[model samples]
Target chain A: MSTKTDKIDRLAELTAQQESSSGASLWREALKRLRASKMALVGAWIIAVFLLLAIIGPWVAPYAPGQQWRGEVFVNRAEFVGARAENWFGLDHLGRDIFSRMLVGARQTLLLGVVSTLIGLSVGALIGSFSGACATLGGRVGQRIDSVVMRCIDIMLALPSLLLAVSVAAVLGQSMTTVMIAIGVVQIPVFARLLRGAMLVQGGSDYVLAAHSLGIRKRRIVLTQIMPNSLSPVIVQATLSLATAIIEAAALSFLGLGNPDSAKNPEWGVMLTQAQNYADSAPMMAVYPALAIIITALGFTLLGEAMREALDPKLRG
Target chain B: MSLLELDDVKVHFPVKKGLIFDRTVGHVYAVDGVSLSVEEGQTYGLVGESGCGKTTLGRSVLRLVDITDGSVNFDGTDLAKLPAEEMRTFRRRLQMVFQDPLGSLNPRQNIESILSEGMAAHGIGGTREERREKIRDILAKVGLPANALARYPHEFSGGQRQRIGIARALVLEPDVIICDEPVSALDVSIQAQVINLLEELQESLGLTYLVIAHDLAVVRHISDVIGVMYLGSLVEEAPSDALYAEPRHPYTKALMSAVPVPDPEVEDRRERILLTGDLPSPANPPAGCRFHTRCPWAQDTLCATERPALKDVGGGHKVACHFAAEIAAGTVERTAASVVPATREEMADRVVETPAE
Candidate 1:
């Protein structure tokens, strides 16, 4: 066997290397792939535009979104001041500016999607972390705890989402909190299961075995080593959950359970609810909110899917 | 007494079936009744093929995998019966260097965290600064730059990562380090560098090692005592020079013949003992001698019915075979045959009895 020490000297020769981002190789490589993907860029663009509109929409609107001015000399009952330069997207049957209402509605929609997703992600991720740790290194009692926790989650998953919302609403009176928490019911199980599964996989990985061999305590191992590695898939799920929340918003709007302040707050879902009443003559009104929700959902979905691909070890070089 | 003595070690993993109410249908005899010892300041190499119990045997020493039935006596203490909390404390004195360099180090943790976390857990140093100082010293010993502490595992080459893996083991200052296939995953030239590094560290640190590997050349190069394993048990054990000069077990003889000789003439003329059929699965191992299922010199009557216990031949050399003396003395004539023997059908019938896992 050759005993040349210079070979190892050359191996560690890159000690003068430039410092990169703090994220691990997995995240850095995934971020690089995301930056290169056309789909991610397009999705990011759509999301950015929606965010910008949500932020500056009220300032740019020509009229107050909730107010209806009857003296603005409207046209026929069916077609009220159709697409004029003065009122823009024209006056609605209630004499309010539809375009301004849509603009201000962007913030409400974004908030609805974001708040619900955040609630689900935080709660589900906590449950997932606990259950995953219990199952992986907890031995007999830990497995039992994981089994009970997962069974509860499974039962929650099996229940109809509407009933989950209604039950939640019953406990905490029906308001903005109820709507957001209820809408987020769809994501709890998905996040918990995803994080738990990720942790289970990393638990079996050689690194975790190495950690175990190091004599590090089991609790510390779970928190520091296992938890960090198990977050990629959960982050991707969080993004996808935003898209799900948007779809849930549509369904809630159809059921007239959307935005309790349908008149004052004027969310996209609220606008859609009002549009259905005038659907026979004003199809474009219904089309606007539907298209808005679809495009937003598509943006989040595209980004989430691309992220899933980027994080997949099988796809990496 | 030897620094590490394992007597009748067994690790049987239960094969469970059915969801919900999981039922243990059977057991996989991973490391069945393995007994060996490693003295302080000496390297004991355990060599075996893919499915052999070398890795499992190494793991059970540190209680990474629980020992089913045995006593692992280490420096006067019985490690096998140590409580989990006590095992954690015991690990400070007994560390392990893993196989995969990249897979062993946490991808998310930097070199500093990776090295220091163990020291912190074991309470090696008094303070954070003391720990960092100790970690730097270890990094230097393992041939890594002081600056490497800031980098992640993926930043370094395979050989460098191995150095860090060794450093992680060294930082613990364990009396005995179990290196499980340490240099097998590295490049050939790099393997030599890593091996040299390990040797240098062992010399300087006065550390004992139970090095497990499949590469015969690598094992022979560094080991003081070498054990050849088959299925889930060791078939032969001898000093490095004695085992290489003359391998008594039929399976070891086959392995020695497979090693390519440097001399061109000898390489061309040397008779190769090419055994037929796949290695029998450990889940359902052969009835008698584990290697008898594929042994060329296997006697039909004794090899298939009675298990062979490892017995001392002479001068510390041990062979677990029914006809070890006869095989070594050449009294039993070689059966007339090609690589595939004439009694293939008989062997096949015997092999068919134990269904592979």
Candidate 2:
């Protein structure tokens, strides 16, 4: 018994020592654990490179994004690759530089993903959290709203996502902002359901109960304690959702719901559409844009999976 | 002035039945019109079986659970009448130590953040550093090393986590604390240490406690007054010694007899009043006296037809029973005694004559 007590004392002393020591910061510890997975690191690097390209692409491009290079049309694709120097990555069907168009397209794709996902997350989080916190009539109303919203998302999901995007974009009329709003509207239900599920889980957690016992305001509890804890999963979901949003935007652009497909303006999806007619002679044009879509989506999906694993405690061990 | 008073507080949860489309149901009376009070600097212990509404009563007192009816007045302020903002202020003065130490404290938060959160929320401490210092002081008072402020809750043992729970409650400098079975989760020796720690803190901080537990022995050691609850109602309330020495209510007697004495010889010798049936469903409790179904000396008509109100017989010992006087006088004997065969009785008598201790 004395030895057992002595062991306990020793354990307590060690804990006291570790608690006092500033050995590892929380972020550093999380990062160290995260880095142990090579796939996750690679995914992170891909995301970082894409983000950098999106931010600085305009400045780094040799020629104006919309300005067409005066060169031989699709016939002199090989010559244009080295001939103009500005027409790097060869020329598109309209003799426009594919590399510059891709850089510009990256800006549009990222903007659509980031803006739409933010809009979706904010609106869904608000509705979901408020519904979770409400009692009596408000609670019932929140539940009804959640069901109706989720049902609408189900209806949207039932139709091919691209088809829905095409129809919504056609009705709203073609513009980048219109495309973003269309994507955001479709994405809201996904976020609402995610936030509501997370809120339900958090509502039963002890910290939430502790907050209640302290008589903290329901609003404060929802905003501070519950919301912060729920964010980790939401963030991973958001990353994957952004990838979907980008793909949907590309689909909308391909279906003539995006920027006008004139000689000066060539989006990656529009480039693919234009290249389809000349597929036998110039297959590189279609292949390049398709590759961009697949690679970008892959980057996001890998990052999302990594983040989900890192944030979920059950999965961590 | 009484620091806290619960006057016939009833918290009933509606029990719904049937499929998703249609349902008809009744109410599960979790805390059915139970009344009790705690004086300033006094520790009131509430003992009962698991579903006996002890926890419900504690939560009702803190206004954590919505009381279906009745008034909970703390320092003359009607808890139900207090506006949301005022109730927030009231909460700073009234804290709670939850049963599960691990569940009570946030796993993500360190000890310092947990201890300082209540103070910061109530705007009690002057500055950040002052709050941190206060946290350090409270940690030390709980017998935890001061440096433990930086540790996460998972790093500590069950006993230490409970101490952290205590520290969190005390750091608020609350006038009253509702400890919901704080040490029941700990080991036997650890339970003693925690009880001692609680007593020491109560004396030093002048803390009033409504300590809820199932263990009668722990309640006897720490409480000034003891309230025995059955089903949803408080069947008995008296001073600790008065209740233990001369239990008035039949339910209280049965409960007291059920507590396992440490001395095995005395434990064996003592008449173990075994309650035959499991506790009745609260949704449909036994008619009249809730304990009447299991009462050894239950008189048919009075036990079934009429509910007994908690009335003080004398010396502030209150019991809610039709035959409190008879039960208090020790006139009632186990009904099973006469039913057992002669051989079994002889063996039982021998065991009773020579208890484990």
Candidate 3:
């Protein structure tokens, strides 16, 4: 027992010294844990490479994403001297370079996923805070409000998320913004429930009760005290949701509910739609875009899983 | 004038049952009709067994828990009558130190933020530099180093965490602090250190404290005045030394007997009056004397039918008992039925048998 306490004391002293000198915060501690996970580091590297490729792909591609090539029999190779070398990943039935299309497709896929997930996260967090704050009141009025908000979320959650997104997309018409809105609206309930549950537990903590006794305003307590502490789980959930958002966006595009400029556009789902006819003959056309979607989703999933494990005390050690 | 006064304060929690809509089935009388006053610069120790509602009474004084009925007057202001906005400002004069040292401080926040939270809320200490200096000063007074400010609550031991808890309250410069079992969760040796620190701070700052604890010895050592509570009512109130020397109430005598005497010879020779049966549920306490069901000197007729009001005996010592003098003088004989052990389950069954609320 003495040795155990002694070790604890030593550990505490070391941390205290480190904290005083560097002013270490919770974020810093989380970063330290993130750095320790090799999978998280690899995911971060993949995301960086993907983002760089998406931004500069148009400038660097040998052929324009929309430029198509005719075969040697149809057109002389000498007339289009660089066509054979440039269309390395070959051409679709539309004759667009599959390699260039996949490169440009990354831009649309990532942009839609991030924007929609952020929209979902913000709306869900707002609703969650409202319901969570009401529940903390712990009176008749609070209980009534809490039950109403939670039941509404339950109704949304009852429908399959993809089906809801599909119907929403169908109504809005074929546009990238519409696709984002559809996927974003479908994910609101997941974030709402996670945040609300986290806040409920945090609201009941002794420190929150102590804050009440100190005469801190309810708003300040909910914002400064409860929100920050309750945010880790919601953050982890958001990362995981981003991966799902990307896949959902791709699915919508594949169903012809995506970008209206299907012929000229290089969105992954549009490429897959265009590549279906030649899927058996030149399987690489389908393989390239499908690989791009799979790898991007895998990156986010790995990072999200690592973050969840990092935040979990039982899993950390 | 007394620093704090509770005039028959009561806090009852509604017991709810139902699936679709919750219906109030009954009430748990956590604190029922408790009245006491604490003078300025004095330590008033509240003692009771677990679930006796002493903690609720302390919280009521600070208006942390709303009073269902009655008034809590602090420094000439009726807290119950004050509006929410006014009460919030008035809260600056009062503060609390919770029982669990670790749980009471925000784990995510560093020591500086935790200690400065009250000051930030009340808008005390004008500038950042001023607030930082004030926090440093308070940390020193609480025996923590200035560097401790950057550390989180989890880094500290139970004793250090308590000192930080005290520092948080003291930084606000409040007139009264309600310490709810502040040392109960600490190690035996650390309990004395924390208790002594509280006493020294009280003397230096002239801070009035409502110390709630179940340990009689700790209370006897620190409190100037002591109030003993049972099933949500004050059964005895007196100066600590006088109450310890000559306990008047039958319940007080029984409580005092339970405290083991240090010397083995004296401890063996002392008469231990063991009270039979469990404490009656506050929701449905026995009519008349709440203690009659377990009191050795209880009379058959009046003790069971009429509740005894807290009346003064002598020297400002008040006790709520029909035969306080006879019981204290050892002239009253124990009723045979009162000596039989009644488990808490049996007592709960009796409460269920009682038809009325």
Report the candidate with higher DockQ, 1 versus 2: 1
Candidate 3 docks with a DockQ of 0.45
Task: Classify candidate 2 by CAPRI docking class.
Answer: acceptable
RMSD of each: 6.8, 6.6, 7.8
Off by over 4 Å in 2: A1-29, A55-104, A130-168, A261-266, A272-286, A315-317, B14-26, B245-250, B253-258, B261-278, B294-299, B313-315, B324-357
Evaluate candidate 1 by giving its C-alpha RMSD to the native, one decimal: 6.8
Residue A257, candidate 3: Cα error in Å is 1.9
Write model 1 residue lDDT over A48-160, tens digit each, in one string: 99999999999998889878877652334566445678777776668788889889989988999999999899999999999999999999799889999999999988988
lDDT tens digits by residue: candidate 3, A213-309: 8888888888888998888888888887777888787778777788887655578777876666555555677777778877877888889888877
Model 2 residue A117 distance off true place after TM-score fit, in angstroms: 2.0
Q: In angstroms, give how far residue B84 of model 1 lies from its true place.
A: 0.6
Whose lDDT is greatest here? 1
lDDT of 1 by residue, B248-357 (tens): 99889888888989987666656778877888988898898887778878787788899899999998899999999998889876542424332445566779987963
**Candidate 2 RMSD to the real structure:** 6.6
Candidate 3 pairs with clashing backbones? none
In terms of lDDT, model 1 sits at: 0.86
Total clashing pairs for each candidate: 0, 5, 0
